[model samples]
Target chain A: MKHDYYPPGIKGIDGDYTAALAGNPNTGKSTVFNALTGLNQHTGNWPGKTVTQARGYYRHRGKTAVIVDLPGTYSLSANSLEEEVARDFICFAQPEVTVVMADATCLERNLNLVLQILEITPKVVVCLNLMDEAERKGLKLDVDQLADELGVPVVPTAAHIGRGIAELKDKIHSVAVSEILPRPKPVTYSQQLEEAIRQLETSLQRVYTNGISRRWIALRLLEGDHSVIEAIREYSLAEGKGAE
Target chain B: MGVDAALNLDELIEHGRELRNKLGPETEIQDEIVTSIYRRAEAIASKVAAQAGGRGRDWNKTIDDLLTSRLVGFPLMLLLLGGILWLTISGANYPSNALAALFFMLEDKLTFLFLRWQTPEWLHGLVVLGTFRCLAWVVSVMLPPMAIFFPLFTLLEDLGYLPRVAFNLDNIFKRCGAHGKQALTMAMGFGCNAAGVMAARIIDSPRERMIAILTNNFIPCNGRFPLLISMAVLFLGAGGLKYGSAIASLTVAGMVLLGIGVTFLVSYVLSSTMLKGISSSFTLELPPYRRPQVLQVLVRSVLDRTLFVLWRAVKVAAPAGALVWVLANTNIGGMSIIEHLAGYLDPAGRLIGLDGFILLAFILGLPANEIVIPTLLMSYLGAGALLELESLSAMRELLLARGWTWLTALNVMVFSVLHFPCGTTLLTIKHETGGWKWTIIAVLLTTGTAFLACLLITQVVQTLGLLF
Candidate 1:
């Protein structure tokens, strides 16, 4: 019942801020990771190119940050291991900044994951990657408008060509240090589901005291996420033992 | 406090379950959530994005139509595969011969040095004749084709054609109750089976992934290519064909197609019986094509794939060469150990249309497939060391002198395609599956199929001969 979702091989350092790179598959997520960390992770032009979570470290503004590249998933549904892994890391490890990368060419499909991530955490940055490909395909994105709409910093990057990387790093640093506060717009569910989530959240507040949103936990529990239920039970027991 | 906390948590979970039941099935709730998210994404995208032109989009659509169309997809895939094989075989011949000459020259110099220094005969034989010769053969035979083939394969992958291949074959795989992504792994197997096994991790379902790993060995890898091509040229092309090399290329390509056929057949059988499960659906995105970076492809393929596989083959082949030499030289009872073992196995080998030397070579070539032909040639000549014939004609003459017919060549090619995977691949299977149980199953499955296929083919050919 231990909450040990971070893959065993990767351990975050004491002073290093942790960032998780989340994206749809083939949105150049790995490319951005390699560019930021200077690590030679293999980048392939295919979906599900990264099946495992790879961790690398990068230094910015005299502070070293550990970056974990999560597997690409379209949604946080427990339909596959990738979705589960990406969901668990974001909810449990709670990396200081979660960079949600999206493809500029197909912004709508990519935005689904961004909306799901925003529901879980406010410390999110939308990286619109493949701007070059998007332009070539005759598509244009208003970066500032996207940022304003989502209530988070949106950096338009062509990670393959190393454009907008500096701005991405700066945003990640500010968010990690609590200098930039992002209040993400939460997705509104059905009124009936919302009523159920509120009731469950109030009942669970007595036992759950982590900084994670109780409403999100309530939603996941209502959705029958067995892992989330188990995580909550473990956290409650640990807290009780500490008090005893 | 702990007991109270545990009770409260259980109560909350129970409450959550009751709520979930009230909401109906998990899928319906999931559908609602996904639809809402998609709707929101659409709204936001509409508000922020605009299209300016359609040139690149049109270009990709046209290419995808030609490549993935039902009528032309299969034929185009085969044509591209055959073209690559033809190029690899034709381009590799000159460099392979040149490399062989250069390595043999070095071998002669090493022999002279040993003689000049009063080195012992057995020592000279072990070092120069046994280990060095085998290493030289593996390098010369493997390097050029890999050097040419890996880049070409990487170029296609870079051009994003591989996904289209998966797209073309997805329905067929679905019918076989396997994942469509298995096509990508099978393509990787053409380069190396171990890599193909590793690539199976991309498949989401555990059941389908196992199917991919188990059947990957049916595809002929780079190591088996030299043997398959040589046999095809010597046997199939020699049958009064004017366009010999072209016919040989077609024959080799046919062998590849057969491997793919066997893969699907095995996948179907396994899915129906041992690894029974419904194939899970996945969204395979066909990315837009991009012009491959020629310099990057060359550098990455040579460094990452070609060198890596060649290094592994050489590491195993060196010790295997020494072992083969010892077996060929040390007499058991007036006959060397190699001859004695082959004699004992000759009956079974003949029953399957292969001779004892061919079977012995396969057994000894467990560590690496590239050494199979060299081992067979050395054993047949009783050379007590690995040897390489100068040309394809010389190899054909040697085999013909030793009672090889077209039947032998055909059986050898068939057996090589269907046999147990090499040692590295078996180890990889074990590692990927996380147990020895699946690895043993993979071995028994492939080896059993190989034996059965060879037996059936041999019987059919003999029956036809009697009829004629």
Candidate 2:
């Protein structure tokens, strides 16, 4: 598919697709980014190495895809700078596909970020990185089962060794082109909080007509995230004027 | 466009605030969200992943268990440290002498060329003996050990063992109300203090970062390695000890441990007094050990680190050497400037178990610690600039001629370990702290500690000598 896709709100982008790489710290997120984009961002063996976002592009199947490597963060709670940056990009940048990378050796801890990303975007492919390390640790992951659980494509990869990268790129291309639709399972909260979120989401939907997720916006609002509230107000004002 | 929409948005924000207030504290909300996410992740992972036969996991656990165990960890650390020092000292000697011979031969050729051109005597002394000799001394002395030590240290870093060092020392730092990452920075200081100050950026807390920056100087940088190694070899390696290399290595390792001790003591004092704050908690992830990339380690350590530090030292040493030459040759009130200055400082230096020339060398070596021994040699030999002895025993004899004893050698090593950081480190501290205030505090704190420590040891030794 030769579909032209820019990041949702950013103008003047010529790429056919935009993909974001997200993961926890030291999960070889940059390795996957470099592998896909063919750019060498220095990878270190410690946490908090990538404090800022790095962007590059790669061509696959006659399509140019721009990939942005978001800062490695544990969650989307907006506590630290990396978290704020990661959350903002996922919420506002609106890339066509987001590949949430996770370490296969420590899947449980890494899946935390994967679940949070799924709550934000349905166009996500969980890249199970460090498969070599996982196998060495005697941990075997059923990729099909994981994909079924998350309702998204799961690609096993050893990014440093350049294994499974072709399949990962193909998955990204398909997901970006809407060839594979992902219906992610939303994180369930308490009943009272769920009621509050539903109420807020209805109010948000009334004001917002863009493709942004009202439920996610409502959860952020209930979490007292001022940045999300400000973003919605700006988006509503900008888009609502033309609609009205 | 409507006033009603803006009012509704304000109401929405107010509603959010209300909901948050109703849901207890923000931390509790965060904790609950994290708990739910973690719970889901655990469930999904358990469902999708299975554990089987033992492999790298078992060996990694067994190794980490021994490496980080309480009884074995400290001794292993010391042994590794001592072994690295032994390797560096023994490996560097032949190469250092060879380089010195080669450079000094070049110096002779330059002198012959100067004479053939009929250059003035004073000008020849200033150019060839002053700047050239100083640069030569620094390169021959510093390049070998750094070339040896940095790659070895980088190998450890690449093996992912440095974080385990931090892990082993974390509880001690926590007890001192300092960030555990300070141990990592201090480990970096073993290579260079300026880099150590920069490494303090890894620490998240401003209070702890400052504490780390301030106390990092207590550890000797690579610039001081040559001097420490030389002193260790001369003093401890004397009397033809059977394990001369081992004895020297132990001495160097003991100095390093002493430096670490002073780092902790100063960190404790700073945290409890000036930079007081609650110790922030962080997760130190011990990464899985990967086989080190030998080619990458060699390139990074040799080019990025070893050469970079050698270049900086040469830059500072050249100008400082010329200045020392001028001071040693210039006479005022019937004595060379250096001699006058040393005589003036001798009493105070003696109070701290150091002599005037040693104190003078330290003062002149402020630009770079690598030049300290060279400066002392120049002043003591009554030469216009730095000179080298043919062997370590000959160098010991020269010190003995100046009334040097084992106590003097011990005190000099201690003083070198505890003294103020060199010029680059001071500037780095200023830049990192974004002000001169903390840099000056760092200088005063380290220099004061060095003096106090030397004074205490000197007096105690003297009193014990009288009793004996």
Candidate 3:
């Protein structure tokens, strides 16, 4: 009751605002966290190196924000602990600005998680890391066009070498304070699935009083993801108990 | 849509559960959701990203092909490991001797100061000889090799070569009926067995995870490396400079190879019998190798690994040193406590090609494998008076004075590689496996394998010697 599923006992993610970092593995997510927090969280070129979440704090534009680095997960399917941890923090904790870090060299694979997170929340900032690597490889992403396409802020960064960091913080600061509101145009499913989600969202919204997006919850319910439903159920019970 | 304030938590769960069924009885909603998400991602990517020459990944594929190729892979892995071990051994020699000389010189100064203060013999002996000597040796012997080895190892890890190792070993793991991810955990075990056991969570199958946990100790961790290196240098490398260093590295490499071989053997045996399972295939994506952060890696690893490991060894060895002094100095009916204990265990230890002091050290080093040689040296300090302790030759002299043969050194190396996991690792196993039963089985499996291996080796060697 006292907490919203931030995966309890995670220290230092309580500030004026909170941002959660999510991405596919080896996408420079932790490097971005270090570049912001100035903390040397281990960054190795190994998947699952970060088996658990790490939390850090940063101050930008006179606003001190707590940044939680969720474990690198491929999807919100919750097939593994990494996925479950990333999903719960995003769905329940609902940080103000969610930075979906993506690899600039292979934007397509990284965008899978970015799109998934967009469905769950509106304020998404796509931190396109490894821009230098991308450039050396003769590849580049049109950052503004990416922003326009995804309906969010896309900040190009060679985060390891500290380029584009200032702009990233500026975007994060504005988004957290709602100056740059991200009305994310998330994925639309088939007609039958959309109809099912609409029917579920109508009934589910009444039971869910939190800031959680109703359509996202409906999609998850239809998909039979037990962890998401179980966590939301418990959160609602606590809310109901606290209300009474 | 907004009139459900009266509904309670129980109703919410019941509604959600029943609602899952209302989605037309599994009409591929999950598949559709996933497909649409990926499709959306692809759509955005097409619009925003400019295509590269598309040959960026070709270099990575070329390297991965050579590294994992059946013809060149295993040999290259062996050479790299052997070269690293060679470098660690060669690089460690001067620094170890210098530190040993420095610490022993300080020990003499501390001894003079203790005598000037008119401290009693037991007090001076405990402080200067037992505790200080162990701390000095642990630092001098343990720090340099780790300082060199770990940075290089971290360089490889950072350069994205470790996963390629796992990739190369996948087929062997598959043949063993264990998950290929076991290779990843086994690679982790080279750093620390406790950490390696924890890394087993990546393996999805419970049976394969158990196999990884039980067999992890076979890959000698950081704690065992110093012992293996010192033994190899002194005993196997007695032939002088050129051949000597090469042989030393080869012996250490050989021991490492044997440890790995035993890992696969034990994994295979377990998977076929007690813990049966099909080896599930996995997607092993090799990350593109990046240029390693050389200066940063050196500073980070030396501080994080070298000094940290040295600090731990000092903390543990100091008290263990005092305990060893007490055991070796205290008299019971004219025989020291260590002598009595060693005497009781002497026959068993002898049959396994080790002395009782060595066996006692292994037992005492249960908390950590790093402390075994420190405790043994401390025991020697009590037993052998006025003997110097510095350098490989001096260490060899000390061992030679205490009646150690080449066979003793070889068998000690053998036993060190195969013994039970350290206490911290056992505790980690308990946490990972969630019970005492598997932990107990782990102990028996490792120690049982060790005792049998050493016994067979010693018996065979000695019989061969007599006939020759």
**Candidate 1 per-residue lDDT over residues A1-244, each given as its tens digit:** 1225444534334436888899998899989999898962332221233455677777899998888788888887756778877876787678899999999988988998999889889999899999988887888779899998899999999998899999999999999999999988877779877788888888887765356777777777787776776765676676566667
Of 1 and 3, the candidate ranking higher by TM-score? 1
Off by over 4 Å in 2: A1-16, A39-52, A135-139, A189-244, B1-28, B105-118, B383-388, B466-468
lDDT of 2 by residue, A112-168 (tens): 899988988899999999999888778888999999999999999999999999999
Indicate which candidate wins on TM-score. Answer: 1
Q: What is the C-alpha local distance difference test score of each model?
A: 0.84, 0.84, 0.84
Report the number of the highest-DockQ candidate: 1
Looking at candidate 3, what is the lDDT of residue B190? 89
DockQ values, each candidate: 0.60, 0.47, 0.45
Ranking of models by DockQ: 1, 2, 3
lDDT of 2 by residue, B1-468 (tens): 545566777877787777777777767766667788889999999999888885656787788999899999989988889889999999988898888888878888999999999999888878887888878888888899899999999999989889889999999999888999999999989888999999898787899999999999989989898999888888877668898878888899989999999888989989899999889887677877878999999999999989998998888888887888889889898889999999999999999999999999998999889999878877776633233454456568888888898788888999999989888899999999999999999999999999999999999999889422
List clashing residue pairs in candidate 3.
Answer: none
lDDT tens readout by residue for model 1, B1-468: 667767877888888888878877877776777787788889999999987875766777899999999999999999999999888877877888788888888988898999999998988877877788778878887888889989999999999999999999899898899999999999889888999999998898889999999999999998898788778878877655787768878888988998999999999999999999888888788887888999999999999989988898888888877877778778877888999989888998999999888999999998889889877876775543233455556667788888888889888999999999999899999999999999999999999999999999899999889322
Per-model TM-score versus the true fold:
0.90, 0.88, 0.85
Q: Assess candidate 2 and give its lDDT.
A: 0.84
User: Scoring model 3 with DockQ, what do you get?
Assistant: 0.45
RMSD of 1: 3.9
